[model samples]
Target: MPDSAALVKQLMFTFDDLVELDPMSLGVLIRSCDTDMLVYALKGSKAPIRDMFIGQMSERAGAILRDSIETMGPVLARDVEQAKNNILQKAKNLAEAGAIVIQRGDNANSQVIY
Candidate 1:
């Protein structure tokens, strides 16, 4: 059997993991995603994760997004998964293109230099 660390490394990066992103990196991700999709994606997300994204935006934009999420009503699980996947893919692409860094584990404490 694989070791615990190896198994952990094999796990997929998830939507909740996005909370680890620095402000600038998170901003890049927010801009990359569609507003409507974001509303759906955040529908049932934890308050902290939702706040992280919303906190990065202007007060008006954040309020609008907060209201949208609050009023988005029920969302299909698959749709939420799809939106999360799309956002994750965008973050991966950004990391690949060197537009942002996704620090993990031991590297999480490192600073992102522009």
Candidate 2:
């Protein structure tokens, strides 16, 4: 796995960066991401992105995710942030491994090659 510093330097999309993507592109990335990464990202992410991820999953998976988030008690801000970072890192790794493609947003000028 790449170091976090190098990962950040590479500047792939973090969860926060999802907001910049069009719905179709964002949905593709969400569906391609690892399940655990989706869980982690959902826990820390805001409503729109969270909804997008849940929407991409099956009914059962979506229900389970919703329940998990509901029953999950308070988590530290830093931990939540770390979870989001982990998702970003995992996506980067997957892209690097040629498991998936991480494309630029429709509005972006340049693509980040993993």
Candidate 3:
């Protein structure tokens, strides 16, 4: 069996989990996040993660964000972690407010009913 810390870690919502969110939920999350923070958080992120976010915005906005990411210099690991945590906190707050659903484990792919 896993230790309590390990269990908690396993249950934690991570930045990568944003991929599981529906488009609308993702849009809400993106809108709530600060653009500068997003640029920092996405500094070393995977292509899919970057693409998912950029794809949700208007062409001009996406291009600007993409350019920002491309031009950004090296970011501190701690800053990246902080930005991701802030975004995750926003997501948790949104979920608690019934504005979005964060599906996990067995419900990860479940459909949402209106």
Residue-wise C-alpha lDDT for candidate 3, range 1-114, written one tens digit per residue: 569875575357678988888889989989999999889878768999989989999899899999999988888999988888788778878977889887765665664321
Model 1 clash pairs?
none
TM-score of candidate 2 on Cα atoms, chains taken together: 0.68
lDDT of 2 by residue, 49-106 (tens): 7887777667998898888887788777887777787767666676677665566645
Q: In model 3, where do residues sit more than 4 Å from their true spots?
A: 1-11, 105-114
Instruction: List clash counts for every candidate, in order.
Output: 0, 0, 0
Task: Give TM per candidate.
Answer: 0.83, 0.68, 0.83
Superposition error at 28 for model 2 (Å): 8.8
- State the lDDT of candidate 1 residue by residue for 1-114, as single tens digits: 568764554355778888888899999989988998888788868899899999999899999999998877788999988888788778878987898888765574664321
Note the residue pairs that clash in candidate 2: none
Stretches of model 1 off by over 4 angstroms after superposition: 1-10, 108-114
The window of 10 residues in a row where model 3 has the poorest summed lDDT is 105-114
Better of 1 and 2 by lDDT: 1
How accurate locally is residue 76 in candidate 3, as Cα lDDT from 0 to 100? 90
Q: Identify the runs in model 2 with alpha carbons over 4 angstroms from their true place.
A: 1-12, 18-37, 107-110
Model 3 lDDT, full chain set: 0.83
Ranked candidates, highest lDDT first: 3, 1, 2
lDDT measured at residue 56 in model 3 versus the true structure, 0 to 100? 91
